[model samples]
Target: MKFSLFITGSPTSTKACHSALDFALALMRGGDHSLAGVFFYEDATYIANQFAMPPRDECHIGQEWADFATQYEIPLYVCIAAAIRRGIVNDSEAKRYELDTSNLAKPYQLEGLGTLISLSSESDRIVRFR
Candidate 1:
């Protein structure tokens, strides 16, 4: 089976993001499932911000998600409008907006909601983490 995921919770604010990762990994380990994409929307866009700094004791969920995406060959898509509203930006966007910095992490691409729609169309299942 192939699946796409939609995440709407901040990693630090709730366990939903982590739980989704766990579930996706388990599916991969089963050898019969694959993740097509992970769409981060609303507050979940924080997970794609490279500039996020959690306490030393806490795990860096942004990096964790980036690594997972790389390891599993899953595309990580962050809603461009949502992310920009939350201060997440890539180099191009930063330049366009004349920002001093860009914080979008690798493996997390900035896209429109259309990407989510496309994922939903291509996937066998679409899971929401919220």
Candidate 2:
């Protein structure tokens, strides 16, 4: 199954992010389904943060997703509007533009919602982890 994981919550103190992450992992491990990639949108798009670090004891779900995405080689995309609105830009983006580079995690590209639309067109199942 060509699936796209759409996350719609902030990375910090956001239930949608956590649930989306969990759901993506489950789909990755599912015996009968195939996952294509993960897409972040709205406030949940903030989950694409690479520099997100909390207390040591606390679970770093964002990093977990980074590692998972790297391991699986799945494409993780963030909405450009959302990322900008939330102030999460990467080095490249920061250079091209001026913004914080905390949210553009590796394996995740900052793109427009049109990308998601294309993904939805190609995806067999578009699951919303909100």
Candidate 3:
């Protein structure tokens, strides 16, 4: 089976986000199961913020998500509108907005709601973390 993912919770504030990551890892490890992509929406867009810096004692959840996506070669998509609202801009968006810097990093790309819909349509299952 193939699966698509949607996260609607803050990485640090909710255990559901971590559970989702663990579930994704398990699904990918299981035979013949593939992941289509992970879409971060609402407060979950913070998971794609490249500039986030957690204290040494705390888990850097954003980096953890990025690393997981990189290791698994999974596409990580952050809702563009939500990202902008949260100040998580990419290089192009920063240029477009004439901002001094951008906080979006690799493995997580800005995408519209259409991407989520497309992934959901293409996958056998849609897992949501909220």
Candidate 4:
């Protein structure tokens, strides 16, 4: 089976991100399931913020997500509107907005809700974490 993940909780303020990661790991290890994609919406868009710096003793959830996506070749999509509203922008967006820097991390693409719909349509199920 193929599964898509929809996450909508703040990475720093909630366990949703970690829980999603755990679930994804399990799915991959199961050998019978695959991930179609991961959509970060609402507050979850913060997980793509490249400038985030958690304390040394804390887990860098953003980096963990990035690494997982890189290792598994899983598509990570962040809602463009939500990301921009939260001050998370890619290089092009930063240039378009005349911002000095871009803070969107790699492995996470800024996309619209249509991408999520597409992922959902292509997956057997959508597991939401919030």
Candidate 5:
């Protein structure tokens, strides 16, 4: 089995991101399937930016996502259109979009809808986390 993920809510606003990470990690443990892709759109795009850090006593949701993706080598991606509009862009994309370079550390890719569609075609099922 294969799964495609779509997260629409911000990580800090909901536990959807953490729950999805747990699900994906469990899937990896089974080793019977692959993560086709992870798509974050709408306000969820903020999860890809490291700057979403909350003050002390708050959970580091974005860091949790980055760590999970890095450890599992999952291709965590955010909607390019959504990210750009929300002021999140990499050095390369920033230049392309004529915007300032933003803080997108690693393990996250700013990709287009085509990536999601491709995953949809390749995966056995499309599972939306939130």
Candidate 6:
């Protein structure tokens, strides 16, 4: 089965992000299931912010997500509007917005709701974490 994940929680304030990661890991370990993609929306868009720095003792959820996506070749999609509202932007977005720097983390792409729609349509199921 193919699954798509829709995450809408703040990585710093909620366990939803971590829970979603755990779920994804478990799904991959099953070997029978595959992930079509991961969509980070609402507060979850913060996970794509490259400038976010957690305490040294804390887990860097963004980095964790990045590593997972890179290893599994899973696409990480962040809502462009939500991400921009949270000050997360890639080089192109920054250039377009005339920002001095871009803070969008690697392995995460900024996309619109259309991307989510497409992912959902292509997946057998969509698991939401909020």
Per-residue C-alpha lDDT of model 6 across residues 1-130, encoded as one tens digit per residue: 9999999999989988999999999999999999999999999999998888999898999999999999999999999999999899999999999999999989999999999999999999999999
RMSD of candidate 1 to the truth, in angstroms, is: 1.0
Q: Where's the lowest-lDDT run of ten residues in candidate 1?
A: 58-67
lDDT, model 1: 0.90
* Tens digit of per-residue lDDT, candidate 5, span 1-130: 8898888877777778878878888888888998877898888888888677688897677787788788878888899999888888888887887766667757788999898898899999888877
Of candidates 4 and 3, the better by TM-score = 4
The 10-residue segment of model 5 with minimum total lDDT is 97-106
Whole-model alpha-carbon lDDT for candidate 6: 0.96
**Higher-TM-score candidate among 5 and 6?**
6
Selected candidate, larger TM-score, 1 vs 3: 1
Q: What is the lDDT of residue 14 in candidate 2?
A: 69
Give the per-residue lDDT of model 3 (tens digit) for 1-130. 8999999999878976788888988987886899999999999998888777889898877777788999989999999999999999999999999999998978799999999999999999998999
lDDT of each: 0.90, 0.78, 0.90, 0.96, 0.83, 0.96
For model 2, the stretches where C-alpha displacement exceeds 4 angstroms are: 98-103
Clashing pairs in 3: none
- Give the distance in Å from residue 119's predicted Cα in candidate 2 to where it truly belongs: 1.1
The alpha-carbon lDDT assigned to residue 113 of candidate 3 equals 99
How well does candidate 4 score on lDDT at residue 63? 94
Whichever of 1 and 6 has more TM-score, that candidate is 6
lDDT score at residue 57, model 4, on the 0-100 scale: 96
lDDT of 2 by residue, 1-130 (tens): 7788788866775677678777777877886777777788887766766666789998777777878888878888888888877777877778777554445767778888898898889989888866
The per-residue C-alpha lDDT of model 6 at residue 62 equals 95
Model 4 misplacement above 4 A: none
